[model samples]
Structure formats: structure tokens, C-alpha cells
Target: MSLKSIAAKLFAGVIYKKTQKWATNPVETQQRVFEGLIRKAATTSFGNDHNFGSIKNHSDFVSRVPIRDYEALKPYVDQVIKGDENILWPGKPLYFAKTSGTTSGAKYIPLTKESMPYHIEAARDAILHYIHETGNADFADGKMIFLQGSPELEEKNGIKLGRLSGIVAHFVPAYLQRNRLPSLKTNCIEDWETKVDAIVEETIDQDMTVISGIPSWVQMYFEKLKARSGKTVGNLFPNFNLFIYGGVNYEPYRAMFEKLIGRKVDSIELFPASEGFFAYQDSQKDKGMLLLLNSGIFYEFVKADEFFSENPKRYTIGEVELGVNYALIISTNAGLWAYNIGDTVQFTSLKPYRVIVSGRIKHFISAFGEHVIGKEVEQALRDAMEDSDAVVTEFTVAPQINPSADLPYHEWLIEFEQEPNDLAAFSNAIDASMRKQNVYYDDLITGKVLRKLVVTPVPKGGFERYMKAVGKLGGQNKLPRLSNDRTIADQL
Candidate 1:
């Protein structure tokens, strides 16, 4: 083994032990994080406005601060944008993670110096944990590619602004810098298609052992590699064993990935966002990611079923229950107070505070009162795929409220790498899985309020073309798994 691989294995042990200290005492660790966040930001303008000074406990804090999405928090964010110090956090933010917003044009999520390290640390520890568990740190000695956004940043009001992935590129640990691939110039290319081509050209023959990115984008790179080299990914990069992904569930893409790579490889799922690094898959054997309670963020959860009701009760880490979907709200050292990042999660393991991202709070189908969520749809499709030979590249679900010949139903727009032999049977299988999981959908189908879901086949590359047309071709952008309306469905 190389010296770096030896050091990585040794370091992984140390990090794993440190993580256990907090992971074992989830409630106490979260309490410390909560108190620290409130105490540190108590003098900021937001704190003063919200009576943060007199907040003695979680109850007091809850009564004083209401959960605010980006739109509600914009006034304070505007002040920060105009170079106002002490408006949100104590002073200026280190950088703004620019992200696409629906109602708002672009959201600038603040990344402060205090909170930035945790993001880097969470990602690093995820890998180290894998190394420690499997005793396979040899990937550290080979080239690794993190397919991501441009490292280039634009200066705004003395603060740098760019995609979160782009901003993080500047902070790659010096030790791994030499192993990271896709030259900076190639990464800076504006177009994703062109960038992937460039990346393929650059790393087609390199000793690639680890690859990381959103699965869809990584699939694109893999497809291009297969076309150019005429070899499966595993054959091309024999050392490649670890695949790291986030932003979307990988189960839907697993079959396609296995076919492309020609083998099964170990993978890690990360729950990261511009707001904060919330969790990472701590064990390959476990079902969910371990929530980072000691990170510089205080978490709150509101039951998803009651989230839209007036004054939904928010539960802290100590109060959440397993298997209940909850809208994740957070307050952080980055100065977001009681901010709803619009994600829903369910606790899979309360003993260690592990969670799975269930869905987006707004991204669901409930046109006919059948509130089908992302997790359900993804799970239903995955179950169907497991029972068949369908190789789906991408898919999305939207309610079809009106039809020319039949009762309204759910429309599944799917792009397939390889189609199933019997499309009707496959669709029935998906519908059956969905009905089993969601009682509302089952009732709707039985009562003839809504018909069984219809699978509308999208031509290969159709979704990619749609994304390019919408000017959100790549780099951390994820297609919503399901939507209430036919906006995406009609376009597809």
C-alpha cells in the first residue's frame, strides 16, 4: 500500500471514534449545537428583532421565531447582499451559495467561516468512515473525479458567489488535490455537455478509482465514456470501486448504473445542501444517513401531513419519532433562523438519529387529494424495477387531472435506457406498488375518482433536452421526482 493509503486508514479510525462520541449522545449533542447557535447569533439584527436575548430554552425560542422560507427571509438577506455587516450573522458571510429558485430568481444561501468547515468535514468523514468500515483506503492512491460546477466565482459586495459545489472546489484538501480530476479549465466550461466531453477526454485513460456527483450527471459522463472507449466503466477503470452520490435517490438509477459499469460497486449516499451538511451514510449495512447533531445547526421538524395547517407544532431532535414524515426546519450559525429548506425526512433509526430524505415539501401530487410523495413514487418504481428487467434512465410523476377518453390519473413520464417487454404489466406493477403504499391513491383508484397511472414513454435523451431548453442543464440541479402540475409532464 502507498503511504497515503496507510495514513487514510489510520486517520479513518480516529475520525470514526470522534463521530461515535456525538452519535451515541444524539440529544445532548443537539442541545449543545442549539444553545451555541442561539448564543453566538444573539447580538445580530435578526436576534434583536426576534427577542433572542431572552430565549431561555427551546420553548422560548420556538415562541419567538416563526419558520421562514427564503421568500420570508429575503429582507434580511437583502441587507446582507448590500454588504451590511451584523445583519444576519455577527459579521459578513464568507460566501453565498447561489441556487436556482422558483418564485425567487436566485437564492443566495450564506456560508459563513464558522459553518463552512462542517460541510467539508461531513464530506471528508463520509469517505473516512467508508475506509474505516471496509478497510479499503486504496482508492486514496488513485485518481478521483468529482463531476461538479465551475470553480470560478463572481464577487458581489466583497463576498464570493457561485454554486455550492463550485465554492467547495476551492477548498479541496491539499493532500487530495493531486488526485482530483477534470482540470480547472475544463470544469469552468459553461455548458454541461461540453464539460462532460472535456472531462471524458481528460480522464478516459487515468487511474480513476472513485467518482462522485449527482447520479444523473455522472450517468451522462459514464455514457460518454462507454461510447468513446467501447468499454464498460469497470473495464475502463478497473480500480474504480467507490461511487459517491447525493441530491437524488440512487435506487431508480441503480440498474442502469450496474449495466453501464458491468458490476456492483459500493456506494455512499450523502444528504448535503447549500443550507448545511445534515447527514451522511455512516454504514453500508444501514438504511439511512446518520444525522450530524453536533454540526453548527439546530434542527426542528413539523409533521408533513400537518405542515400547511395553522401553527404546526415543531419538534426538536429529542422529540421526533421514527417513520413519521416531517418537514425539516433548521437554524444555523450561517444566520438562518428557523429556516425551512423545503425538505421532508423520516427517521429510519432513532437510536442513532439516522434519517432518509423522504421528499420535497412542495414537490408532490395531490390534485385529486391523493398526496403521493417523492419517496413513495421512487420506492414504488424501484419495487417494480426489481421485479422486472426495466432499465430506467430518469422519470417523474405528475397528476393528469384531465384526459380525452378516460378518468384522470397519474402520468409517469419515463425515459428508459432499455424498455421492459410488457409495458402494460410494468405500469400495472408500478401502480400496484403505489396503491399498496398510499391509501389515498388506492381509495382514489377503487372509487374511480382517478384511474391507474399511465406510463408515458419519454424518448431517450428527452429529459436532458428539456433541462437544456430550460437553461438548467447541470451542476447540482435535480429534476423533481414528482410535481402537482403538468408543467414538466407537458414539456416532456
Candidate 2:
């Protein structure tokens, strides 16, 4: 083994042991994080406003600080944008992770000097955990590519601003610098298709072993490589054994990926965002990512079903239960206090606090009171695709509240890479799966309040074309698995 690989294995061992210390005492670790966040930020303007100084415990904290989404938090963010210091966190934020907002135009999530390291650390530890568990550090000796956004940043009020992935690019560990691929110039190319072409040209002959990105963007790169080289990804890069992905569930894309790569490869699922790095898949055998309790964030959860109700009770990490979907709320060293990041997650293992991203809090179909979520839809699709010839590239579900000839129903806009022999049968299978999972949907169907779902097959590259048209073709952008309205459905 190379010196770097040997050192990596050693480091992975050390990191794994350290992680186990906190993972084993998850609730206690979270309490420490909570206290630390509150203590550290107590003197800030937000803290003063929220009575952080007088807060004695979780109850006090929750009572004082109401959960605020980006819109509600914008006044403070606006102050920070105008060069205000000691508003959110102490002093100034190091950078602003610029993200696309739904109602708001642009959200500038603060990345403080204190909190930024955790983002880099969480990503690194995920790899380390993989290395430690599998005893495979050989990938460290080969080229690694993270298909991501431009590293370029814009200056605003003395703080750098860019996509979170772009900001993270600047923090790649020095040891891995030589192995990282897609030249900085290529990455800076504004157009995604052009950037993928550039990336393919750059990494085609390299010894690529580790590839990371949102699955959809990585799929684009993989497809590009297949087209150019006329070889399966596995054949092209024989050592490419580890695929790291986040932002969306990989199960939906697994079949397509297996076909493209021509084999099954080990994969890691990460739960990362601009707000914080919450969790990462710690074991290949496990179903969920291990929640990072010792990270510089305090977590709170409101049951997903009751999230919209007046004064929904927020539960601490200690109080959450397995199998119950909860809208994740967080307070962090980055100065977000009781911030609702809009993601819903379910605990799969509470012994060490492991969770699976269930859905977006706002991204759901409830037009007819059938509150179908992203996880359910994704699961339904996966169930339908199993033991079938269907291979989906991408899909989204939206309620069809009105129809020309039948009762309203769910419309599944799907872009299939390989269509099944019987479209009606495939649609029926999806509907059945959906009905099995969601009782409300099943009731609606059985009572004739709604018809079975209709599948609208999007033409080849239709979703890509739609994304490009909407100016969100690449990087961390992903299609919502399901939406309440037909905004995306109408466009598709």
C-alpha cells in the first residue's frame, strides 16, 4: 500500500474510535452540544432577543425561541448582509452558503468560523467510517472526483458567498488534493452539460476510485462517460468501488446506476445541508445514517403529522422515537436559533440515534387531504420497479385535482430509462404500492373520491430540459419527489 493509504487507514481507525465515544452516548453528547451552542451565543443580538441568557434548559430554550424558517430569520440575515456583527453569532460569519429558496428568492445561510469545520469533518469522517468498517483504504491511492458546483465565490459585506458545495470545495483536505479531479477551470464552467463534458474529458483515463455527488448529477457524468468511452463505468474505472451521494434518496436511481456501472458497488448516504452536517451512513449493513449529536448543532423534532398545527411541541434528541416522522429543527453555532431547515426525518435506530431523510416538510401532496410524502412516493416507486422491467431515470408526483374525463387523482411524471412492456400494468403496480403505504390515498381511491394514479412518461431528457429551462440543471439542485401543486407537473 502507498504511504498515504497506510496513513489513511490509521487515521480512519482513530476517527472511528472517537466517533464511537459520542455515538454510544448520543443523548448526553447532544446535551453538551446544546449547552455549548446556547452558552457560546448568549451574548449575541439574537440570543439577547430570544432570552438566551436566562435560559436554563431545553424547556426554557424552546419556550423562548420559536422555530423560524428562512423567511422569519431574514431580518437578522439582512442585518448580517449589511455588515452587522454580533447579530446571529459572535462577530462576523466567515461565509454565506447561498441556496435557492422557494418563497424567498435567495437564502444566505451563515457559515461561521466555529461551525464550518464540522461540515468538513462530518464529510471526512463518513469516508473514515467506511474505511474503518470495510478495511478498504486502497481508494485513497486513486483519483477521486466530486461532481459539484463552481468554487468561485462572490464577495458581500466582507463575507464570501457561493453554493455550499462550492464553498466546501475550498476546504478539501490537502492530502487528497492530488487525487481530486475535474480541474478548477472546468468546474467553473457555468453550464452543467459543458462541465460534465469537461469532467469526462479530464477523468476518462485517470485511476478514478471514489466518486461523490448528488446522484442525479453524478448520473449525468456517468452517462457522459459511457457515451464517450463506450464502456461501463466499472469497466472504465475498475477501481471505482465507492460511490458517495447525498441530497436525494439513491434507491430510486439504484437500478439505473447498477445498469450504467454494470455492477453493484458500495455506497454511502450523507445527510448534509447548508445549515449543518446532520448525519452520515456509518455502516453499510445499517439502514440509516448515524446522527451526529456531538456536532455543533442542537436538534429538535416536531412530529411531521402535527408540524402545521398551532404551537407544535418540539422534542429533543432524547425524546424522539423510531419510526415516527419528525420535521427536523436545529440551533447551531452558525447562529441559526431554533431554525426549521424544512427537512423531515425518521429515526430508524434510536439506540445510537440513526435517521433516514423522510421528506421535505413543504414538499408533499395533500390537495385532497391525502398527505403523501417524499419517502412514501419514493418507496412506492421502488416497490413498483422491483421484479419489473422498468428503469426510472427520474420522477415526481403531484396531485391531479381536476381531470377532463375522470375523478381527480395523483399524476406521476416519470422519465423512464427503460420502459416496462405493459405501461398500464406498471401504473397499476405504482398505484397499488402507493395505496398500500398511504391509508388516506387508499381510502380516497376505494371511496371513488379519486381515481388511480396516471403515469405521464416524460420524453428522453425531458426532466433535464426542464431543469435547464428553470436555470437549476446541476449542482445540489434536485427535483422534489412530490409536490402539492402542479407547478412542476404543468411544466413537465
Candidate 3:
């Protein structure tokens, strides 16, 4: 066997067994991870202040360290930025992962030595698990291209600042680097469009077998590849077998991606954020991703419906119920304690602790008390385009709370690559689908409390232009799908 195949098999043998044990005893694994993180960081300022030494279990830890978001964590992060050691994690962080800042201004997330491995290892385990189940290991012999951010980092104080993917790119092992595409020089190109062109030029003739990236950017690369090669992705790279994606759901982009590739490829969905590497899709038949219980991160869940309450109930992995949407809270080895990552998820399987990312806590439309979410909007769009020729390149929805003349409504700005033959019918189809999916929306429409959802067809490349203008055109930069106010709507 080749070196690549041997490494993959050896890696899979270990992680697959760990995953099975994790599935069988997730509670034990989580408890051990949480206690270990607490004990390891007990000497840090935040940990000392929170009395980590006195904390015995999850309940004690929860009581000691109150939940916080970015704003509350900024002071400690600021100290780290100023070259303070042991401010959060032990010693100083190597780099700070800058968020896309689509909803707000850019925020810097710290990455420590203890935590960086989780990001890299989670990705490896995702692919390893796929191989374990499917017996498809031949792809390891060929190259894999990861569409990530620039590897060149900027130093702030003593810490570096760059995208998470860019930060991780620096640590690609020597063995894997040989089979990875896009030379190190090309990866340092700051501009996303320019970098993609360079990547296409570099990898056009390589023996590539695996592709990993956010769906939208990968789609852009595929389009450019097709344009140059005059063939589908499958024809261009016949050995391609795996497509690993995250950051956004692949449902809306499924049809377009299938068309670009010209064949169905095995896919694995991962739930990774600036806060932590959380979960990944393990089974093709299973819809939800298996939560990583031993990834040096402690998981907590606050019921989504009660998240805004004065005292929201928090549940651990041992307490979470299947089918309920819960806002995710995480405490990590990187010194984040009960940090709300602003993402919501629903448990689909309790046995293995599988979850589906429901939506963002802040990215929801409830202006008129009708709660609509990213999932609903995506599903509504999927249903709307099922019978039509419409293909969405990008979209965002916002509330028109007080229009000059018309009643209050949700305005949808959709950029379509292929327009539907009947535009009015497409609009009606979207309106009908929303009503069918959401009873509250249906009730509001029936009572004439809100006008029909307004559909505005944006010119091709409108959203991409907007992202580029905002300096967020590349890795992990996702457009917010829903907003409670007219901020997004007016901007569009």
C-alpha cells in the first residue's frame, strides 16, 4: 500500500474505535473533558477568579462561571492582545481567528496550542470516519484541495490575526503538504478572487481526489474550473470521491453543485466555528452530525424557545432531549467558559448525540411575532424552486416594518443564476411555501396583519459584490439569511 493509504488506515483504526466508545458513553466522555479543561486552566486568571479549583462537577462549574458572549469576553481577550500571559488560556495564544463580522464588526477569537489540534484533528476524523464506514480509502492516494483563507498572518501586539482556515494552513503536516494543491505562495494572496484564479491555474492538471471548503466559494472555484476546462467537475477530476463542507447548509446549493460536478460525490458536513470544532456528519443515512464529546470542549444547551428569558434553563449532554431546538453554549480548553456561540441546533438522535444546526440565535425574523428562521427560509426557497427553473446564487431576507405605503412584510432579495420562466409564479410559490411551513406566518397572512412576502430579483453577482465591498468575500463568510429589522433590507 501507498504511504497515504497506510496512514489513513492506521488513523481510521484508532479514531473509529474512539467514536464508537464516544457514542456509547458520551456523558462520561463529556464530563471527563470538562473536568480536564477546568483542572488544566485552574491557574489562569479567569479560572482562578471563577474558583475553578472549588468546582466539582458541571453544575458547580455553571454556577461559578456565568454565561457570556464576545462583548463580555473582550476584556480578557484585550489583555491577551497586549501580550499578557495566562489571561485566558495558559500563556499567550498563537493567533486570533478573525470572524467575517457580517452581523457585527469583526471579532477576534483566540487560538491556543491546546485547542488548535481540535480543529485539525476533527477534520481528519471526519474523513476517517467516512472511510471507516464506506471502505473508500483510495482517495487518500491522490491530492486534496482545501479552499481556505490566506496563510499570511498579521501580527497585533504579540498575537497574529487571520481567518481560522488560514491559521490552520500553517500547520499542515509535511507528508500531507506534498499531496495538497495550491502552492504556499498562492495561498498567501489576500484577495479571494485573485487567489481562486491562482488555485485554478495551479490545480487544473493535478491528480485531485478530495475537495474541502465552504459550499459557495467551492462553487465559485468549480465554475471557473468548468469555464477553463470546458467540462464538468467529474470529467475534469475523474478520481474525485469526497467533498467536505461546512459553515452553511448544502440543501439550497445541492442542485447547483450537482450540476457543476455532473456526478454525486460522497460528502461530510462539519459544524466548526471560531469558538470550537463541534460536530461532523458520520453516516450518509443519518441527517444530523455526531457531536464531538471529547474534543477538549464542554457542551451546554439552552432551550431556544427560552433563550431570551431572565433565567434560561441550561441542559448538558446528559439532559438534552431529541427534537428540541437549543442555543449552543460552549466552554473550551482555550479558556472560553459558558460562551454562547449564537448558533441554535436541534438534537436528532440521543443515543449518539447527533444534532442539526437549526439557525443563528440572532439571525431570525420575528418583527411581527411570526418567528421564521434560516432553516425555514432555506426550505421555503428549496420548495419554491422545485418546479421552476430559478437557481439562487445568493439570498437574504429582512423585515419591512414600516414601508411608505404598503403593509409590513418580509422582503427577499434573491440573486438568481437562472431566472424562472414565470417570475410572478415563482414569487407566489415562495409565498405559498412560507405559509405552509409556518402556521404563524399563515395566521398573519389570513388575518391580513402582513402583506405577502416581497420578492426582489437582484442582478447577478449582487451579493458577491456586497461581500467584497464589506471586505468579507472568502473563507467562512456567510450571508445572514434573516434579520428582524430593516437594516439588511434597506442596505440591499
Order of quality (lDDT): 1, 2, 3
Candidate 1 deviant stretches above 4 angstroms:
none
Name the top lDDT candidate.
1
lDDT of 1 by residue, 296-415 (tens): 999999999999999999999889999999999999989999999999999999889999999999999999888899999999999889878899999999988878988999999999
TM-score of each: 0.99, 0.99, 0.95
Lowest lDDT sum, 10 consecutive residues, model 2, at: 397-406
Under the 3 Å rule for N, CA and C atoms, how many clashes does model 2 have?
Answer: 0
Better of 1 and 2 by lDDT: 1
* lDDT per residue (tens digit) for residues 1-492 in model 3: 676787788789888998898789988999899889888889999988899899998778777888888888888887887888998889988789987553446788998888999998888888888888887888988888999888888999878889888888988877788889888999888889999999999999988899999998999999999999999999999999899999998888887888899999989999998788999998888979999998899999998778898868788999999878789999988878899999999999998889999899989999888889888899889998898988888888998888898688889999888888998898889999999988899999899889999889888878888888877787778878888886756666
Q: How do these models rank on TM-score, best leading?
A: 1, 2, 3
Better of 2 and 3 by lDDT: 2
Alpha-carbon deviation at 240 in model 2, angstroms: 0.5
What value does the lDDT take at residue 316 in candidate 2?
A: 91
Better of 1 and 3 by TM-score: 1
Instruction: Compute the lDDT for candidate 2.
Output: 0.93
Instruction: Give all candidates' CA lDDT scores.
Output: 0.94, 0.93, 0.87
**How well does candidate 1 score on lDDT at residue 157?**
91
